[model samples]
Target: MKHTPYYLNKPDNILPKGLTNSVFRSSDPLAYHQSLKNYTVTPLLKLNELAKYFGVKKIFVKDESYRFGLNAFKGLGASFAISKILEKDPDIETFCSATDGNHGRAVAWSAKLFGKKSRIFVPKDTTRARILAIENEGAVVEKVDADYDETCEFAKEMSRKNGWQLVQDTASAHYAEIPAYIMAGYFTHFMELEDSIHTLPKPKIDIVFLQAGVGSWPAAAAWYYLNRYGVNRPKIVLVEPIEAAGILASFKKGKRTKPEGNFKTIMAGLNCGIPSLTAWDILKDSTDAAMAIEDSFTKQAIRELYYPTGDDKRIISGESGAGGLAGFIALMTDPRFRNLKEALNITAESRVLFYSTEGDTDPENFKNIIRKKK
Candidate 1:
């Protein structure tokens, strides 16, 4: 996450009407199925101990774990994006997506709620547990041999051939609309985070570390803060797996960059080599910086979640859900991050807001890793 001098053309000013309101409170992910739906996103308890350990201001993880059966913030993007796409021309047959894992699950659950059939295509090596989770939701899963990008192309081709509505998130003119809808669903995330921060004792959120897949959720959340609060907005940091740092690299290079290598990261949700165009557009204007973390660092973050000294069982979160905290820890551990750390003054007073996006979305897999600690 280098922030060298670079220039970007002025960004777009297209704010969706879905974000203008602040009454987010949907208990059912299906009920609030839009870009930004029902949820008073609340500020979870900040670990004063962890804050001091990190030598940064207060660190409060904004909990998105309370969404419909699905826990991660992807609920916001996937549900809303898919709904918007369908609303224009509701497809009764099938909704399709390519994913490392989470996004596909989200779309499957969403399609089920809307009384639609769904199909998910995942890389051949995708864990049976993750794919099974989607199947448990009643959506059919197709396994493809190859990488994430390849699966995505297969999903598109299959959708075209089968007349299914392809709910692809990586942006394009037609697909860009879905990202916009996805971002709209995330407005509640910002609304709830702000509400939670305001409720804190010393409630100034200095920084917000967010993980990016298609980049819509975090980008839209930060954009809402910038538009409504201006200088009051928290410093936004975008995180991704190092192997799939395509968007971050593109932003850093002042031109869009897409990687050809197979994305091999444990943080599946953050493993996209190409990002949503709409999501990218907003991040270009709103983000303060970006960072990437190795899969090893994400594993270390899993340790932090489980090792809550003195028997407080930390909530078992999916690996993808831990991406932001992983990147933050990665940044702190890096020698290059030393100077950036000093410059950012990321101390306990910082009131940093992060997200634990999902819970044990894949239980057996999560248990396998957790059991190893014993």
Candidate 2:
């Protein structure tokens, strides 16, 4: 199945009016996150050379590679969700979740920190490096033969049977509270980025290209920017792997939906088949556009980041981390996506922002890809 890059524009009034009154605005999560040990704001870097290449006014990449020493942004949500769960059940004995890699490790790390047992479930094809990372944190790792969504269901059942709290980020109507905590936890990243942008002299980020999996992260980002900037909020572009474009498919159908078939992609972290219901509610009306791109484009993006042009700083963005940049570059360079570029009002005056959500999470595969390039 050859997948082509695709984009869709959202309706003008898709979002609700006055997002400032949203439930997430009641308390500031940043203060709690900042008080944690070793919590430092991740770097928001200016990619001058890339900006010039794309003919954009400015481009900023929030590098989540060093976030909480987890080499991914998952920790921000995992740690906070676990803390909130523990606050309610101080005597909770076990925690559990499912993931392709990063999120499960985060759950394990948080569980270890809180002095509780953890059980992490991953798809059978999950990389050894990620499994080792999870196990290293004292969590029992289980590899299931099914895909990510199936693994998530299996993990949910396991948690229920054992009376363990499930910390999965994707939410259903019946299971929304924990995922809401996880999404709220992601506010730490946006809060820091907002502060960093505010400090800039121009502070003119016009658009954001957000990579989506189960849609929690992007929804969190959309919530923050919409509330903070209101009508002036940056345009949000949701990017995903074509093989697992659940959010994009949902957007096309005008409702929440799941992608069919086995969701396989090199960008493991973004290979989620189902969209979180909680995230869908926030993103459905808030996002400006949604896009799905081929896997090869993401590989090209990884190489570009690894061996940057001109004086651009070299970044070690993993397969999943590079998707947003890949989507952005596609819109700028591919003639077929010219309509998308124009619709989003991407011009030389447009300042753009995106995230490198992880570093070399799978070190062996990273080494192989980088070495193959030579």
Candidate 3:
């Protein structure tokens, strides 16, 4: 089947009533993170030049490249989930998980920090840099000749056989609480973003563009914003690579559904074929719209961030990290996506927010893309 870009607005009839504030009272996993050495909040950069280019009032990006020194936001979730798991079973000897890249590294890092052994599984096609990064964190790397979804299954089996604590980010009927903790851990980013936003002169965020893989990050963010702002919550747009736009497919079907095909995309971090069950529960009713974009758009967005035109600050965002910017730029510049722009009410006064979820996680690929253009 030929993949085409598409957008779908959430049906009003199915929109969720606001969730209770109590849900977030003890939900943040940041307290454990703060206890770690050298912990710091990532920067919320205001890209005035990009705002001018897009004809928006403001554009703020939560740069998560340096999160926990892991170079991606995945550390927050992995660390939080693993920490919580260890609290219950202090004698747990091993931890395990499957990843496209960043999440595996986070799991390994957390394992190392807690003085536990870890075994991480990755797809055959995973980049060498990512595998090496995971190994450097003291985890045994197991390469499976399968796609990410298959690797997840392999990891699950391995975890059961070895009695290792599984820290997978996606949830199913059999394994829900751990993934919920993973999602809860992700709240740290939003909590930090909220504090940063309050420091701004104009604190109102009009629209939020979040990129989705299995949908955990966006779900966590959407939940935080929905509860924090309630009726005044900003419009949320979920962006994903066209090849693996599982959440987009689900939204289009008006229920959860998996995307078809190889699920390969340059945005490897977002190359998930299935949406996390817990994440889907939150996004199904909370998101305002969903979008699928081509790999070329993400490439262009990387270059845009690396060498911005006008006075925009240079941002070293990786392919997956730039997907939100790619979707936002597509809506603003591409005639084909003009309707999506209007549907999201992207007016001149709109102040948009995006999360740059990673940096140059794959350094060689980052250099090739940014340097080739130069």
Every model: Cα RMSD to truth: 4.8, 2.5, 2.5
Compose the digit string of candidate 2's lDDT tens values, residues 1-374.
Answer: 24435546554534444322343655567887888887999888888888887788888888899888889999989898888888888999999999999999999988988889999999988989989989998999999999888999999999999999899999887888788788888888887865668433334688889999999999888877766766667888998888889988888778899875357788889999789988888888788888888777787778878887777788889989988998997787778778878888888898888899999999887877777561
Give the 10-residue window scoring lowest on summed lDDT in candidate 1.
19-28
Quality of model 2 by C-alpha lDDT? 0.83
Whole-model lDDT per candidate:
0.68, 0.83, 0.83
For each candidate, give its TM-score against the true structure. Answer: 0.84, 0.93, 0.94
How does model 1 score by TM-score?
A: 0.84
The residue-by-residue lDDT of candidate 3 on 173-280, one tens digit each, is: 778778877778888877776565733333468888899999988888887776676656778899898888899888777778898756778899999968987788
Worst 10 residues of 2 by lDDT: 13-22
Residue 101 error, candidate 1, Å: 1.2
Query: For each predicted model, how many residue pairs clash, with residues at least 3 apart or on different chains?
Result: 17, 1, 0
Better of 1 and 2 by lDDT: 2
Quality of model 1 by C-alpha lDDT:
0.68
lDDT of candidate 1 over 120-167, digit per residue (tens): 999876888888878987789989997777788889899999988877
